[model samples]
Structures are given as C-alpha cells and as structure tokens.
Target chain A: MRYKVTIAYDGTDFAGFQMQPNERTVEGVLTKIVNKIAKNPGKRIQIFGSGRTDAGVHALGQVVHFDMNTQMNEDNMLHALNSMMPLDMSVKKVEIVSEDFHARFTTHGKRYMYRLSLGEFVDPFKRRYTGHWKFPIDIKLIKAAIKDLEGTHDFSSFVAAGSTVKSNVRTIYEASVRFDDATQEIVFEFYGNGFLYNMVRIMVAVLIEIGSKRRPVDDIPRLFQVLDRNEARGTAPASGLYLKKVYY
Target chain B: MRYKVTIAYDGTDFAGFQMQPNERTVEGVLTKIVNKIAKNPGKRIQIFGSGRTDAGVHALGQVVHFDMNTQMNEDNMLHALNSMMPLDMSVKKVEIVSEDFHARFTTHGKRYMYRLSLGEFVDPFKRRYTGHWKFPIDIKLIKAAIKDLEGTHDFSSFVAAGSTVKSNVRTIYEASVRFDDATQEIVFEFYGNGFLYNMVRIMVAVLIEIGSKRRPVDDIPRLFQVLDRNEARGTAPASGLYLKKVYY
Candidate 1:
C-alpha cells in the first residue's frame, strides 16, 4: 500500500533533506522511523520526498510518499511516527494513496517563499528563520524586477555553479515581493512548475542587489540574454528559503 | 550620567533577568558590556532593570537604567553596547536621563502577553516562543472569565508560593484574549498597575482550565475571596510569557 504524508520541519539542525552516511538529515530520520514501524515486515520501507531542501531551509507543506505492508491505519501511523520523531520535525498528515501517485514525479508545481528582515537589528526570535539584510533597499526597483522574472524562460544565469541539469528552462507562474509593515519584513514569493538547484536563492540575491541600487533594474531582463552564471549576483542564504507548498 | 535604555531579549538561553553569581542572565551580560564600555571610569557600573523576568521569559520592551562616567553619545553607546552583547540580547535605544529617573520606581503600569498555540501540531518555528496547549478550549468561557479578571483586586491567591511582597493587591486595567485565526494562536494580553509574582501566569492557567471546562468559570472571582495560593491552578510555563511593555 502507498501512503502520502505532508510534513513540516525546522531545518536549523538538519544537514539537509537527503540521507547521508553520518549526518542528521530529514530523510535519514524519516526513513529510520518508517522502517521501525514496519517491524520486521521482511523488507525495509523506503520514503521519497517531493524534493530535496538545502541545509537551514524550512518547509511548511513538504509532501512525501512511501510503501508499507503494515495493517496500521493512517491515524495510528501519524501518532506513532510523531511520538518518536524529534522536536524539530513533525508529520502533519498521512493518507492512503494509489501506487501510481508518486510524490516527486507526479508533482505539478511548487511555491517557495524567501523572507528578509529589514530591521536595523536582527530579531532574536527570527534570527534562525529569516535572512537579515540591514542595508536600505528601493522597493520600487524590486517591484519592477519581479515583473521581469515571471513567465517561461531559460534561467541559465540564475542556476548555481556545478548544477548538471541538462535543461535550465522553467516556468515561473508568479513572482512578487511584498513588505510586511508590522514585522518590517520583505517577503519574496515564487510559484513555478520547477526550480533549478539554488535557483530561487540566486534570483533573490539579484533582486536584492537591484533593490539596493547596486545593480540596475534592467539587469534582470539583461541577465536572461547573457545566459552566463557569472553575470548573476551571489546566491542568498538558505535560512530565508521555505518550501511553502507542493502541488501534485 | 544616568542612561535609560529600552531592551529586547530572547530568554531561551538566559537563566533569567537578574544577575546571579554563576548563571547566564540578561542583567549579567548587560552589566558586563556596560562596564567594559565604561573602561575603568573608576567604579564598576551596575544596571537596574524595571523588574526581574523569570527564566525562559522573553521581553520586547524592557527598560533599564544605569550610571556611567563616559563621554560617548547615545548613538555611539548604542552601537558599542550592541556590538559587544551576545546574539540573544540587544539594546534597542539608549538615552541620557536625569539622575532622579529610576527604572523600577518610576513605573505606573505594565503590559504582558502570553501566547498559547492550541493547534494539534505546534509550529516548529514558534516552538521556542509559545506555549503549546493541545486541549480543546471553549472560547466563550474564556471570554467571560477574562472579563472577571479586570479591575482592582487583592490577588493573594494568584501569587506564587515563597513570594515575599507585603501586598498582593494589584489593579488590572485591561484583560482580554484574542484568537488569531491565521496562526491559530490564543494571545492573552493583560495591562495592570502591577502584577504579583507569577500572577499573570497563574491567571492564565486558571483561565485555560476554565476554557477546557476542567474548572468552573466562576472560579476566577471566587479565588479572589479565598486569598489562598493553593486555590489557583498551576502556573503556566515561562516560555509563553513575554514582558510586552513597561509604562512609567
């Protein structure tokens, strides 16, 4: 039987999403618990996530799927899994699904949000979750640049170095930057069919640079023509990135 | 010159607000930085807080006063003190005030906010800042009880055991509970001329019990007459309490 699970995690302590030999990764912990629940059903159960999240990245609705032979119901599985999981991670929901429904391959689109704290001093409570950018930013320039990022385009310049993907073409259905008055936070939300390795972070860095007037607002549209990674600014930190939602 | 400073701190790592012989405290850290900035002006400077906050209690606008023999202006002092203070503590403002001004004695009232996360799954990001209460609550009962807590009353029943204050009488100016639908959090805000030791926490505990139907709704006003500390519910955890503001 196949099961789909929605999970949320604070990635501050995890190495990343993928399983590594010795490091504490989200996948490593999930796999440990899933197999333990199988309880010698003769085969180790394996879980697959919607996508990999980098270290220090958070997730609000990350979806995953796995196969298990146990007769445990969804409620019992959720209770048992959450009871043994660490404090930083939790299983929000679990449901039985058709075997054909794959968590990764059957995905349609995803949404990611990057949070920037614009205050003079970093908020101690939000230090672990938000990227602190104390420099002044021109909100008008950022709004203009966000408009250029929407639509289907080959985001080669925004791809991180060492990414071996053969295709850099991805569709960004929506992109916008909004300032939260109460918290003095700048939030960048991106919705797209897919994203390249560190693509969102790199795009955020360029937007911030443009917002700060360090780079011309026209540079965003110009970078698409260059198709060179060096033409883009540095990638933003992973702490600000959140896997907001996954669609299937 | 005497300086009055507005401060904010994440108390997750501090023992409390007061300086102890060996504990890591907000006052201990602030005093160290102030003295270092003083640079052997001859006497070791001491800091006086508006009041002591218990361990794991956060503060958003705590006021403190101290004397220093330094020529540095407010801007430079703010920069120097913040640069040297630990990541968990920060000085929001520094102003030279009259020597007659006192942080504790000049006070007229204070406002406290206690956050409760009533969801089945606690938000991982807010886990450190809010208290998780998973039990179902009756909002109507809580609202009625909140109204009963306002106004002047002898809150001897709400004081913590071993508190040495001569008078447990305090005036609650405003008390209310508002539910935030977006975060599914219940925030209890209290404004009072003064709060007895653990008074707000105990009040919250009894309110929660009433909300959960574990205790009768009239128990709030009834406890005021009993004047017995043992009559109240257990004190709420310190993690959920925040010294929101101190007024003078």
Candidate 2:
C-alpha cells in the first residue's frame, strides 16, 4: 500500500532531507522508523520526498510518499510514525495514496519563504531560525524589485552551480517581500512552477541586495538577461529558508 | 574590570547551563570564550551566572559576570565575545560593572516565561521552543490559578526533588498568564526574588492541571500548605521555559 505523509521539521539539527553515511538526517531517521514498523526485511521500502532541502534548511509542509507491505489505517499510521519521531521532526498527517502518485514527479509548483533578521547583531534565540542581515534595508526598494519577479522568467542567474538539469526557465506565480512584525524580520515568499538548486536562497540574496540599495530595484530582469550566477551577490543562509508547500 | 554580560541562548543542544565533563553547556562555552580573551594563564578568571537553566531550556536576558585581566571598551568586548560565540548563543551586551555587582548575589528579582502550545499534536518547528499540551486548556481557570501565585510564599511544593537549598521561601512580585495570539500559545510570566530548581516548570504543570480541570482553580494555596513536591502534577518540559531576565 502506498501512503502520503505531510511532515514538518525544525531542521536546525538535520544535515538535510537526503540520507548520508553516519549523519543524522530527516530522510534517514524517517526511513529507519518506517522500516522498523514494517518489522521484516522483506517488507522494507524506500521513501520519496517532494524535493531535497539543503543542510540547515527547514520545512513546514513537506510531503513524502512510501509503500508498505500491508495497508494500515491513517490514524494508526500517523500515531506509529509520529510517536517514533525525534524532537526536531514530526509526521503531521498520513493518508493512503494511489500507487501511481509519486512524491517528486507530481509536484506542479512550490512555495518557499526566507527570513532575514534586520537586527544589528544576530539574536541568539533566533540564530537557528533566522538569517541575520546587518545592513539597513529599504522595504520600498525590495517591494519595487519584487514586481519584476512575477510570472514566467528565466531564473538562470539565481540557480546555483552543480546543476545537471537542462532547463533554467521557471514561472514564478507569486513573489512578495514583507516585514514580519512579530519576528521583527524581513520575510520573502516565492511561489513558482518549480525551483532549481538553491534557487530560493539565491533569489533572497539578490532581493536583499536590492533592499540594501547595493543594486537597482529593476536589476532582476537584467540578471535574467545576463544568465549568469555571478550577478547574484550571494546565497542567503539555508537556516532562514523554509519549504512552505508543494502543490500537486 | 568586572564585566556584566547579558547573553541569550537557544538551549536545545545544551546539557544545561552548568558545565559537565564531555558535554556541551552554555557556561562551559562562555567560560572558554572569556578565558580565551583574558589571554594570560595568570589572568584566568571564573565566570558566574545569575542562575542555571536545565537542558532544553532557553534564555533571552540571562546575565553573567567575570573579571578580566585588562579593561576593554564595550563595543570591542561585545564584538570580540559575540564573534566567537557558537550559533546557538550570543553576547547581547557587555558593561564594565562595579566590583561589588555580583550576578548571582545581587538582591533582586528575575523574570521567566513559559510557553505552552495548545496544538493537538506537537508542531515540529516549535519542538525546541514550546511545550505541547494536548488537552483542551481553559485560560480562565489558569488565569485564576495564577492569582494565588503572586506575592511572597513558601514554594516547597513547586521545588524539585533534589534541591539542597535550605530555604524554599521566595517572594513572587508578579505572576500572570496570557494567550499569545501570534503563536497561538499560552504564555505564563513570573517575576520573583528567585526561583528554586525546576520551580517554574512545576508551577506551570500545576497551573496546566487546573486549566485542564484536573484540579481546583484555587489549589495553588493548598499546594503551598502541603509543602510536598508530589502535590504538583508533573514538571513541564524544559523546552517551554525561558529565563527572560535577571534583575540585579
């Protein structure tokens, strides 16, 4: 039986969503727990994530798919999965899914949020959850820059190196920047058809550069035209990025 | 110069505030950094904290004091200390305090905040920052129970089992319970002369019991009269507690 699970993780302690040798990772732990429940070597199965998140990146509504030897009720599955979860991760929901429903292939769009702190220094309690930006930011500049990010665009400039994918073009359905009063930090949200490797973090860095007046507000389109990663200042720290959602 | 440093830390990965062999701790890290800055074996000095927080507990304004071999400007001191701080901790402020101003010995109150999440299941992202209470909580009952907590009292019932302190008597200047709308969590704040080992967590447990209708609304006074730790339901998880401030 195949099942879909929605999981959330603190991500501060995780190496990433992918598994690695001798490292504590979200996928590694989850795989261990789910397989442990199967209790038989023959019933062992592999789990699939919507996408990979880099080391130190977080997620709220990350979805995953897996198959078990026998069908189980959702509540029992949720209880079984969540009860064994570590303090930093939880399987929030579980549901039976079609055998053909793939976690990665079905993803049509994604939403990501990046948080940057404006404090003169990094707040200790927020160190794991926010990326610090010491420079003064003009919200108006970022807001103006965000207008150029809406709709379809070639985001080659934002994609990080080490890409094996052929296409750098993606459609951003929504792009927004705002100050989160409660957290006292700047929040940037991007919803796009698909994001390339480190795309969100790179875009966040470019927007921060615009917000700090290091670049013109209308420079995003020019970067697309240049099709060069060097035009982007730097990738924002992974600590502040959250995979908010993956819409199928 | 004797310097008073206000520090904040996310204690999720710490063994506790006090140092222990082969364990990561807040005090150990601070002492190491401070002594590193002293730069002379002969000038090595001990660091003292206002109080200790248990493993997984957090702090926003915890204060400490240490004497240095030489006087240093506050900005440079702040920068020097903070730059070397681990990701989970930060030195928020440094001041050249009077020789007599001891962090733990100064006669004043302290402020603590306990965060309890009302979610049916633990939110993984908040696992390090909030305690989960699955039961439905009545804010009014908890609020009423909070009133009995204000002012001076012999809080023997709230003290943990292993406390060796001779006096359980302490003055609570103020106590209040409020719902934080932004996080959808119940926040309990206490200002007092001092707190015993695990006192705040025990009181929080008792109050939560009251909110959940397991005890009388005015049971706090009776718990004080009982002078027994068993009277409290259970200690809340350390993750929910934060040492908000140490008043000198």
Candidate 3:
C-alpha cells in the first residue's frame, strides 16, 4: 500500500533532501527508518519528496510518499516513524493514499517563504532561522518592486546557473513582502505553480538590493526584458528559505 | 573604570551562569573575552552577575558588572566583546557606572517568564527554548491557583532540597498565566523582589499539576501553610525558564 506523509524538519544538520551514498540527507534518514519498520532487511524501499530543498533550508509542510508491505495502520506508522526519527525531524501526518497518488507529479501549487532580520544586531536565538541583513531597508521600495513579480513571466534571470529545466516560464499566483514590527523581521511569501532551482533565493537577493537602494527599483521589469541570468543579483543563503506548503 | 553590561544568551550549551575551573560557562567565556580585550594577561579581572541561572535556562536581560583598567570606550568595548563572544552569547549594552553599583545588591526587582508548548506535538523549531507538555490544561483553574501566589509568602516548600538560603520569604509583585492562541503556547510571567534556588521551577511544577487536574487548585495555599520543604511538587526543567529582566 502507498502512504502519504507531511513532515517538518530543522535542516541545519542535513546535507539536503536527496539521498546520497554517505551524506546525511532527509531522504536517507526517512528511507532507513521506513525500511527498518517494513522488516525488509536487505531490500531498500524508495521514498519520494515533492522536491529537493537545498542544504540548511527548513520545511513546515513538505510532502512525501512511499510504499510498504505491512498491515500497520496510519496511526501506528506515524507513531513508529516519529519514535525512530531524530528530534530535529518529525512526521506530522500520515495516511494511506491511492496507489496512483504521487507527491511530486500530483502537486498543483507550492508556497515558499524567506525570512530576513533587519535589526542592527543579530538575535542569537534567531541566527539559525533568519538571514541577517544589518543595512537599513526602505519598505516602500520593496513593496513597489514586488508588484512587478506577480503573474506569468519568464523568470530565466532568477534561475541559478546549474538548473537544467527546459523552460523558465512559471505562473506566480501571489507575491508580497511584509515587515513584522514585533520581531523586526521582513517576510517574503510566494505562491506559484512551481519554482526553479534556487529561483526563490535569487529573487529575494534582487528584492533585498532594491530595498537597500543598491539597485534601481525598475531593475526587476528590466530583468524580465533581458531574460538573462547574469542580469539578476546573487542568490541568497539557504538558511532563510522554508518550503511552507504543497497543494494537491 | 567600573562598567555595567546587559547581556542576552541562548544557554543551551553552557553548564550554567557561574564560572568553574573546567566547565564551559557564561561567566567563564565573558571573563576570557573581557580579559583579552583589557590586555591584562596575569591580572584576572573579576565579574559579577545578578544571579546564577541554572543550566539550560535562557536570559534576555541579564545584568553584570566588572572592572577594567583600559582606555576603551563603551562602543568599542561592546563591539569587541560581541565580536569575540560565541554565537550563542551576546552583549546587548555596556556603559561606565559608579563603583558602588553592584549587579546583585542595590536591586529593586526581577521578572521571569516560562514558556510552555501546549500542543500535542512539540514544535521542532521551539524545541530548544520551550518546555513541552501534552496534557490538557484548564486555564481558569490555573488562573485561580496563581492568585494565591502573589504578595509576601514563606515559600520554603518551593525551594530545592540542597539550597542553603537563610530565609525563604519573598514578595511577588505580579504573577499570571496567559495562553497565546497564535503560537499555541502558555506563558507564565512572574515579578518578584527575589526568588529561591528552585522557587520558580517548583511553583511552575505545582501549577502544571493543578492545571492538568492532577492536583486540587487549593493546594497552593495548603503548601504555604505547611511551609515544609517536601510539600511542593517536583521542580520543572530548566529549558522553559527565562530571566526576562533585572531592575535596579
């Protein structure tokens, strides 16, 4: 039977989401526990995630699916997985799904968020979860620049150099930047049909530059005209990004 | 010159606030950096804190005082200390003060906060900062129980067994419990002139029992009447406690 699970993880110690030969990855740990629970001994079971989150990136609602030959129910499976998983990772939900349900292929949309701390000093408690930007930011300029990013556009300029996707066209349903006064954090939220590799991080980098007045606010629309990766700013760090949700 | 400094620390890795011969402590690290910045190699400078926080307890506004024979100004000293301190510890402010200003003495009051996650599952991000309790809690019962804890009272029952205090009488200015629906957390705030070795922890433990309906709501007054060291419940863990502020 096939099962679907929603998980949350603190990715500070993980290499990435993909399974590698010797590195500690999210898929590597999940597969190990699932195989052990299935009592497969020598056989390895495959678990597929919605997409690969880069190293040091966190997740709140990452989805995955796997098949196992056992009579264990969803509650028992969740309990077993949570008991065996490390404290940094947890399976929030588990359920038996139809055999044809695929976590990646059946997804309709995805949401990602990036957090930036704008205080003069970095908060020790928030150092691991937020990107620290000590420079002063003009919120009005950031809001104006974010308006040009909503709708269907060719985001080739925002795609990283190593991404090999055939097309850079994607539809963004919503995009906005808001400052939280209590925490002194600026959060950027994006909901789209899909995202390219390092696309969100690169977009955040450009917005940061525009907010700090290092780059012109009109540069975003100009980048769309050029459609060249070199026109965009540098990619932001992975520590600030979080895969917030996956829609089926 | 004598200097007074306010600091904040995520104390997850330290043995405690006090300096020891071989343990990694907050005072040990601060003394090392302060001595290095002072350029006084063999003259070990003495530093004093308001109180010693137990291991794993965090602090948001802990005050300390130390003396140094250097021409470094306040801004330079603050920058130097923060730059040299580890990521988990930070100096919030530094200012020259009179020699008679002591962190422990000549005090007015102090405030502490304890964070409890009431959700069925612990949040992975808040694991290091909050204490997790999965049992159902009655807010009204807790509020009623907390009212009896205010004003001057002999809290011998709440002190830890090994404490050597001459008296257990302390005046509590404010005590209350509130639930935050946004984060699904219950926060307990206390303001008092002083606290015993484990007074706050033990009070929280008994309150938790009353909130969960394991103990009667009136047990607090009974314990106060008895004034026996063994009458209180077990001491709560150190992870949930935070030294919010020290007033003088």
TM-score of 2: 0.94
**lDDT, candidate 3, A1-248, per-residue tens:** 89999999988789989988989999999998989898864567899999999999999999999998888899999999988888678889998999889999999999999999876677878877888788988979999999899899999999998898899999999999999887779999999999999999999999999999999998988999899988896888888899999999
Per-prediction DockQ scores? Answer: 0.51, 0.70, 0.56
lDDT of 3 by residue, B1-248 (tens): 98899999988889989998889999999888889888854678988999999899999999999999877789988898888988778888999989889999967999999998876676778888888888888988989999899999999888998888898999999999999887778899999999999788899999999999999999998999999868785887798899999998
Candidate 2: docking tier: medium
- Write model 1 residue lDDT over B91-145, tens digit each, in one string: 8889999988999999999999999987777667777788888889988899998
DockQ-better candidate, 1 vs 2: 2
Per-candidate TM-scores read 0.93, 0.94, 0.93
Local accuracy of candidate 2 as per-residue lDDT tens digits, B4-57? 999999998999999899999999999899889888848557889998999999
Q: Residue B21: error of model 1 in Å?
A: 4.9
Candidate 2 residue runs with Cα over 4 Å from true position: A40-43, A69-71
Q: In order of the candidates, what TM-score does chain B achieve?
A: 0.97, 0.98, 0.97
Off by over 4 Å in 1: none
Q: Highest DockQ among the candidates is held by which one?
A: 2
Q: Give the runs in model 3 whose Cα sits over 4 Å from its true position.
A: A40-42, A225-230, B227-230
lDDT for model 3, please.
Answer: 0.90
Candidate 1: Cα lDDT at B193: 95
